[model samples]
Target chain A: MLTLAGVGKRYRRRSVLAALDLALARGEIVGLLGPNGSGKTTTLRIAAGYAWPDSGEVRLAGEVFDPDQATLRARIGYLPERVPLYDPFTVGEYLDFVAAARGLHGPSRASAVARVIAAFELDAVRTRVIGRLSKGFRQRIGLAQALVGEPDVLLLDEPTNGLDPFQILEARRMIRAAARGRGVIFSTHILQEVAALCTRVVYLHEGRLVELAVDGRDAGLEVRLARASLDAVRARVHALDPAIELRSAEALGEDRHRLVFDLGRAGVARAELVRLLAEFADLESVGEATPDIEQALNAALAAQARGAAA
Target chain B: MRGFVTLFARELRHYFVTPIACVVIAVFWAASGFFFSFNALFVAAPDMVSAFHNMSLLLMLMMPLVTMRTLAEERSGDTLELLLTLPVGEAAIVAAKYLALLVILVLMLAGSTLAVIPLALYGTPDYGPILGGYLGVFLLGAAFAAVGLAASSCAANQVVAAVLTWALLLLMWFVDYAAALDGAGGAVRWLQHVSFSVQYLDLIRGVLTRGAVVWFGSVIAVGMVVATQVLRARRA
Candidate 1:
């Protein structure tokens, strides 16, 4: 398990991460969804104890709070975005190095390396240099290294970034297997991957926490976020504006549900709808209306350009 | 400590698995062999100090090649993140790398000692200066490797690391050139204090002065700390 509390980071004059909080528990595979520069990688880096945050602390397994402690970092396995590797070392050698570096020695180290090689299905290319492998194999090897030490927490940045569909499937399978007894949190831009693999999803926007949703049914959105209950949110919304009509409501789960409004009967303004949803459900993003990340980024960039011209 | 040794082993493996280490060792052996045969090893003074000095200079040239990729390649290749995020401290990472470079230097230095074989067979080779020269060159190699490690820590790539290391070593070579200048002052004294070759020459003269030992020791210590700080800066 891992928890990041009030974590923030700034590079020079640019604020890369605002006050953010995230908690991931064992057996939970959460996907951090965000566009580029959304502080997803920074957050993950801080959680992995690779980067020290300007203001905040990361606690692993609830008790080990100091990121400066080297031994505490052993409980974490991180796969950076680029999947940095020594090209000349073979797959087995690299994994063995990582295992030993994590404090595994002798028979234990060898078995750990062998286990990851088999788990990632890297036995075929175990003897080949990493540089000679294809991109997919390279990604798998990176994953294997992260899985080498069998750490309790896994921090992966864009594990499926450049992989093909088959490779992505294999990666997902590996990630799921890794999460069986550990806390798994990976960042990605793909929506379907989150829907298919994550039991929970956190959305970050402009370096701030935007939404946190739970996929309880393994079908629809079921999450407890905003650190509040659905009934508490509904009561707040009712207090704000009682006349807001709710045509239909469906309870997807105790914490997550769907509410439909009459759009034609009375033109509901976006502001009121947002307020109702914000107060009715502890969700930063509502209605599953986010177009793919590419389109959203384009629109934001276009707006920025227009603003610059003005 | 296990992390350091583990990382050290991996670094040694990296040096050999790539062609760089082999090329450096082979080049050193060939060049030393050529010099011992043609540079009048026995015609000059009885000792092989000059040959040893030349070997020291050769190490100055080859150390940057061995150490350039120690941290620079890690940064460029993104492996530093993977390594740093493990249960290893920044100091440990730097020490492991510098230790690996020292091991490589030992291998090459050991190979170069073969030149003394024919000297013993053909001439009355005094073992005193030879032993002293080996110690001198080995210490000199450590200083060069440390500087190379510091340079590698700051460089963006291996090529840049190599260039910067060469420049640093060259500066150390020439900084104390004016130790005997007419207006000898703070700068000259400073250079004399820091000059790597100055400290190394004492060991070649068969005298292990405290100043010489401290000079090489400081370089090894300060250079490693600088390298560790460079890596630690990333966290900030």
Candidate 2:
């Protein structure tokens, strides 16, 4: 697990991260969602101990991160946004060097190199120099290097950048596999990646933690009873819970109606509503609605804008 | 320490895999050999010591070109981030790079030993002065490599690294020249004391002065320390 408290970084006069606080649990894939220059890379760099923050502390697995501490460094695997790699070295050679640098020696180092090569499906290009490989292969090699030591934490910056659709899916599968036992924190501008790959999402804007949301917790469905018309169903739902705001209502067919409700923190249970509706007419089937991450992200941004104006 | 050796091996491998190291050693060998042969055969010199002296100047110029890519190329290629993020310390990274350049210097200096073969075949070659001259050349190359590495650390581009290293070496070469000028004694004395060629010249003449040895060693140490600081500060 990783925790950041009161973390702030300033370059010259510009503040990159402003008192941002976040905690990622073990086996949880937390996606850092933000636009460009939202301090995503800076946060990851600070967490990886590659860059010293101006203020605040980072704790990984109960130990405070010290820039001079090599033991803590060995517990972290970081894939920078640029994926710095030596072009002339073969894929196996690069991984071997990284493994050695991480202090794995002899047979253990060789075994780690072989394991990551197989895990990333890089056996075909094991002997090929990284410079000759395609962009997708190079990215895979980068990921392979990061995973070589089997660190306790993985910090990846835009791991899916510059990949094709198939490669992206493959990378997602690999990331999910890596997150099975370790704490994984990845940053990206893509919203859908959070829904597909991350269990928790942290939104950053202008160097601050804007919002944190559980991926599937904020969605609910509204069902219209067959005994009532669309308007009647809306009115009945409104009567049951005065706080339920009707978003839209329409008649599907004879005696069947569809109604959408925006529950604003009134905490109305679907079963209770269905049971209450059964008194007036026969209750229809109920299903939960899924809210898009993009919509939630936009709403968060809009709320931040309004708060800034206020 | 193991990390340092691994990094050193990787850097050395990089040098060998690319043509940069080969081209530098080959060109230096060809030029030094030609000059030594011409002075010995055509001019009928009694010894190869003078040839050794002239070869030192060539090393002052060529060592920078060989070492300019050590850190500068890593910066330009964006590989420094990868290196710094590893569990290795800053001193290990600096020492590894320094050792890699030292290996190349040893190979090139060893190549110049072939010039001694002809001298022993025909003329009476003094093994003492030859040994002393080699020690001096090795120290001079080490110092040059350190200075070049420092320049490379400060430079963002390879061309600028090479040029800045050349300028630094040239200044050291002319330190003695400026020391003889009027009213420039203070600045000149400091420069002369740190001059790579001046310290090296004493060793070439078969004189193993402690002051000269310490001077060259200090140059290497100070240069490496500054380079390490630069890397650390940049990461910070």
- List candidate 1 segments past 4 Å from native: A64-67, A214-310, B41-46, B178-183
Standalone chain B TM-score for every prediction: 0.93, 0.95
Candidate models: Cα lDDT each: 0.79, 0.83
Clash pairs detected, candidate 1: A214-A222, A214-A223
Overall local distance difference test of candidate 1? 0.79
Best by lDDT: 2
Alpha-carbon shift of residue B43 in model 2 (angstroms)? 2.4
lDDT of 1 by residue, A1-310 (tens): 6888888899899898888888899888888888898889998888888788888778887765564589988888889999888888888888888998899988999999999988889999999989999999999888888887789988899999999999899888888887889988999998788877887777777676644423322112223345456556555655665544333233335425444333322245655667556645565444432223233333334444545678
Off by over 4 Å in 2: A220-289, B44-46, B185-188
- TM-score of predicted structure 2: 0.89
Supply fnat for every model shown.
0.94, 0.82
Q: All predictions: root-mean-square deviation over Cα?
A: 8.1, 4.1
Candidate 2 lDDT score at position A2: 87
Clashing residue pairs in candidate 2 (N, C-alpha, C atoms within 3 angstroms): none
How well does candidate 1 score on lDDT at residue B164? Answer: 95
